[model samples]
Target: MAYENVEVIKRLFQRLFRDEFPNLAPAERQAFEAQLEGRIEGLLRGAAGDGKPTDFAGIIGLGPEGVQPFEDINYPRIKPDFDDSVIPTQLHAVAELYYIWQHEQMKIFQVIDVLRRLFQLGQLRIQRGPGARGLYILEKWKPLRYSRRDRMIAYRRAFNYGTTPAPAGAVVNNNFHFQLVAFMSAFAQYFRDLMISEVIKGGVALSERPFGSAATIQRLGLDLRYALDRASYGNILALTTETGQYLREILELLDTPDIKRSFDANTKWDVVEQVSQRHLGGQAELSQRAKMAESGRRALEYIAANDFSTTLDISVFHAEGKALAQHAEAWIAAYRMTAEGRRFPGVERQLRWALGVGERTARQRLTA
Candidate 1:
């Protein structure tokens, strides 16, 4: 089923860019279309190893095709703000397709590492910022938005709130490049949105005061921050399955300066590795003095139970570690501000955009 979506996705791309370059001469247009088709083919091939893009796409929507993949299921009771569009439409579909496909087929760490490989293969550039974020540049796409200040060149809206044009030197000549940029831009937006929405769903309101009305703000704030401590620990444990190398590279590339500073390299790796070894099959009975000894016992038991070549089924554990890391970062930040009685910088508008939800209304539900 996943493989079938590959062709469907390819056809979608073909239609999107077909003959969109009307200004080109006849021969030039034909050549451009040929090259465009090849590039689209390559992109699909690169992503083909995992299952269909449509499989993951189901989590977000019915897709461009109106098919519901899963059966009747009940999701947790969440606030009205949570929805499929927590991510941008184009980007959300692509990310879910890519991440879910890879996650279903590979080890958690391998899935995480693929992001760097994709960036290299697709000719994308990542520029780290001073915060827990970074900029993804499709360097061959289009000129960046610019401005003049004191007769000096300046980049206007450089970040563009997660969408920006290419730098000073870029090739905006071909229609194919433009479409590639569009796809990559959407991918970046999806990545940021996932991190944010995950944090929010874990219950830390991004905005100091959620929009709609004052009466609901305090209640929402209390409910939103309700799970901060749990979320922090949960994301950390989930991130533990990721290899030390994978974690380091991703943190640096994604410009998570805050997280980078939180722990030294050795400590970071040790924590994740220890967690992986300790919680392979299930949690050890917690004891005050035997924590390390208990972990060793678990590791030995795991080795004894499995053949040397067989990979242990550690997906659930790995997922928890990754989730722990992501939620902790956002949760910690939100927690500190709340602790100090500081509001979350009045980001109601941005929060609305991120959640894909409108003004507060009735509660809604979704299936995992």
Candidate 2:
């Protein structure tokens, strides 16, 4: 078996060896061997003490749990990379455990599903360099080998063969791109550390200009021309989220320019009202346009059906237009109930309360 014996593992790998390196170039093999050994040692430590791991035998173990809370399966396949060939154990016993054990498949690659939400995460890293491609890399959990630089390099690499590789440039393409991914990951880690400090220090200003590897190095190069200008950076931060954020952006925008100063309640409300009006029309539809439109229709129907007294009841208790939409529904409901006569009891009470034109009825109120 490919697993179960170090000799078996070696032989299997030897088959893929296009060329053998029996004479490993000095520490080349040593570094690889040490990292592999360390990975195996990590796996062993995970297995020795545990109640029982479902995939105990098949996996080399991830971390100390002997398994990671990788997948949310009810009973099994909870950990992934659990039984992967890259388990790193060259020992015979561990190999045997892996080769002999049987388990359900785990969906580890599905983790990439979160990439869609990557935009909402912390700021993206924009790598700019000569001959670099613009990339918008979504920040993700660490220990992953991706970086901002890698994404940017990917764009540059894209030109080597474009979408499909060209026959003539195959060799050059392979060398340039195949080796650039690690730098991207390293840059990401460094950027993440920097962003956190900016957020705490610059607040909303930290997100001035948003870019990812999808951006061009030329664009960044031009931008960097004035990157040293703190005033420019502050103004840009106020308009769009960007790095090299200036704390003064918040102060200037608030007209407080003084961090040591504080705004009173009334002054703060003025700021809120001003900003609110500025952003009033910017609220995009939360879901599909159809869904939001339908919700709006239902909201108006509920308001027109009921008057203010009853509208309050529906908005709080029923889902429809906001506090303002309440009375319209109650007004509508009351109009319909008037024609119904006694069919709609307590309808008038709601109508009166909603309209604010009259007192609440003695017998029943909609809220009660």
Candidate 3:
């Protein structure tokens, strides 16, 4: 399905580029289109399918040449050292895996860049601040991650972002607000691993007797290892992208004495308290949903209808929900700090509705 979307996008790009680059000679235009097609297909081939490599380097666009579809072709392993047993074969395996992952990520970024260009988003006033932007991303992703009612709730929050404001003493906390998207986006793409990692980290506990079995334990260990590696890859991808600058800026903000003081020692306690309450509330809602279904078949139907993962995996849902809430809070606080918070302009509301709640909400959340 995603491959189909890419194909559609490629077609659109070809059409748009032809119109935009009319000055190019016929041969030059044809060559450029070929280049674009080649790059997109190569990247897709390189991307990992189901947590395993496609065994292709998947290098997108221009780079150092002679990088084989598999890294082993470029960096063949040396023979095993029977005597000293130094520089083992496992090291080569690890290296090859790393390179393949890197190249796949490179392709993801490249594709993202192409979309950004197509959207012409650079012309927009994205500098409105992190709070607004965070809200914007939440709105954008809600459709991708939620169902009808859930998505509508997200839409309301996005709407509120444009018109809400921080209370007198409340902090907008842009540091937390802006970087939310980058982390959440990365997490969304790698949530299976994130769930596994949470289990391994003691953040989520298993109650079943199966977990006590040696086979189960061994399988869990392997899963945890893979989750850790995948999480690392996701983090690296997030931190290196353009939005990742927000993550860097967040750290830099903490370096300021006054800004650092804004977060009291009780912040951790508050966060934990909020998370616990929200998790319980979510569980209650889930139970209510189950009752509404009233039967096994209906429950399956409900799950099928829902756009988001309705997995019994509470840990993953909690993490995702919390991130969504955080972005919403940040956006609201920032909106409140601005003039738009006092009384939202009706025209703006209409415009927001037309643009989709997320876009309007994000725009409204901008600092005055």
Candidate 4:
């Protein structure tokens, strides 16, 4: 019970697209990890400011006043389980959910909205050109929206988009690889919304029709909303966070040039608002991670196993930050091209890919 929150964050990361991110120079990647730690510290020490009710924010952490309250508060000690079985489960739930979301949100005009959410999430990547001179886009996505009708619709749709069989050339060929840990990390936290509630009901000898957040709403035909604490809150957030990141990654592997154009076109929102969001999402939850694993993210996770919400917080922060960074990188890489469709390095010509880009366009960019 005490370790519930930490479990949430761990599961969130396990569901991410970490395999493709190793593209950075080893040193650069190390540096990226380092920066992630500082961010981790800020994230876990959440937004409950000076002289405020401690319970108001998601988690209560050592404030800028710089003091760990280990003495004043009795830490709830619990060991977390980051098992392997969780990965496949997380992937299945999210993949299913995404199939549902697409059915609902992908209007002719809103395809751009869906794609933009994915691009901004930095979960997936796009093929722009070849190697060093080649560029790729990060697939970032927004969290999926859930409503009673949407959930029912999703159930009806399933993950099989069997409406039309497209020609082989029309579909982008992508072998989207994900790190095992990222995969499990997400499942350990998120699937609870769709599964563990039943487990809890069984444990408590309650009804099969368990009540969630919108219990009082007539939508689900529920009677009352149940009370939740660190565990459930962290679980939903982590699951949503992981799925959002995944959507971003998938989008990147797409060569939706028009979508890319739209993101660039929205240059009006101001740097502070835009860049800050790109680099600093989910920080409230993730920053507290100790400087472990290059950044404090996994490191903080190492120390705060007993503090469930804190662990979940840092994980959520990391997922959001990574997605935003990847999206920004992918979008910017588009501009770093030439008429011949080549970037700066010879690698582009060699890879001959467009991970998310259309093939001919990807070739032009790579050759440029």
lDDT of 3 by residue, 1-368 (tens): 23444456568766877676678864465466556666765544443232342233434413345443433222221333322222222222222323222222223222222322322454322334442343344346531222223322221221122234433443222222122222222223233344566678776443321212222222322332232232222122322232334323322322333322322324322322233343323112222222221221221121122223211234444443444334333433333333333442322232232223355465776433
Q: Relative to the unseen true structure, what is the C-alpha lDDT of residue 264 in candidate 3, on a scale of 0 to 100?
A: 32
Q: Against the hidden true structure, what lDDT does model 2 obtain?
A: 0.28
How many clashing pairs per prediction, in order? Answer: 15, 42, 4, 68
Task: List residue ranges in candidate 2 displaced over 4 A.
Answer: 1-248, 251-270, 278-368
Who wins the TM-score comparison?
Answer: 4
Top lDDT model: 3
Q: Return the clash pairs for model 3, or none.
A: 57-69, 164-336, 165-336, 166-336
Question: Candidate 1: lDDT over CA atoms?
Answer: 0.31
TM-score on alpha carbons, each prediction: 0.16, 0.14, 0.17, 0.17
Regions more than 4 Å wrong, model 3:
1-307, 310-319, 339-342, 345-354, 357-368
**lDDT values of the candidates?**
0.31, 0.28, 0.33, 0.31
Summarize candidate 1's per-residue lDDT along 1-368 as a digit string, tens digits: 24455556777876767547666765465467667767765666555433333444555665565555433211212224322212122222222222222222222233223333444564323334432232233223212221112001101111111123434553221121122222222222333454576587784333232222322222222222222111222112222222223334543543344323432324333322333343344222222112222222232222122222111122222343343334323332432243221432223222332223332421231111
Residues 127-152, candidate 2: write the lDDT tens digits.
Answer: 24210111122223332243333322
Ranking by TM-score: 4, 3, 1, 2
Residues 1-368 of candidate 4: C-alpha lDDT, one tens digit per residue: 12343345445444432653467664365455556655544433332131233331223554544443534332243234432113333333433343324322322113334334544565324334321011222222223444334343322332222333333333211211111112222322233343465476665222233332212111111000011111122133344354455445433423334333433533322221232345434111111111111221221122122222322333343354343333223322331342222442332232332133545876777678
User: On a 0 to 100 scale, what is the lDDT of residue 316 in model 4?
Assistant: 47
Task: Name model 1 segments beyond 4 Å from true.
Answer: 1-354, 361-368
Task: Please report, as a residue range, the 10-residue window in candidate 2 with the lowest summed lDDT.
Answer: 99-108
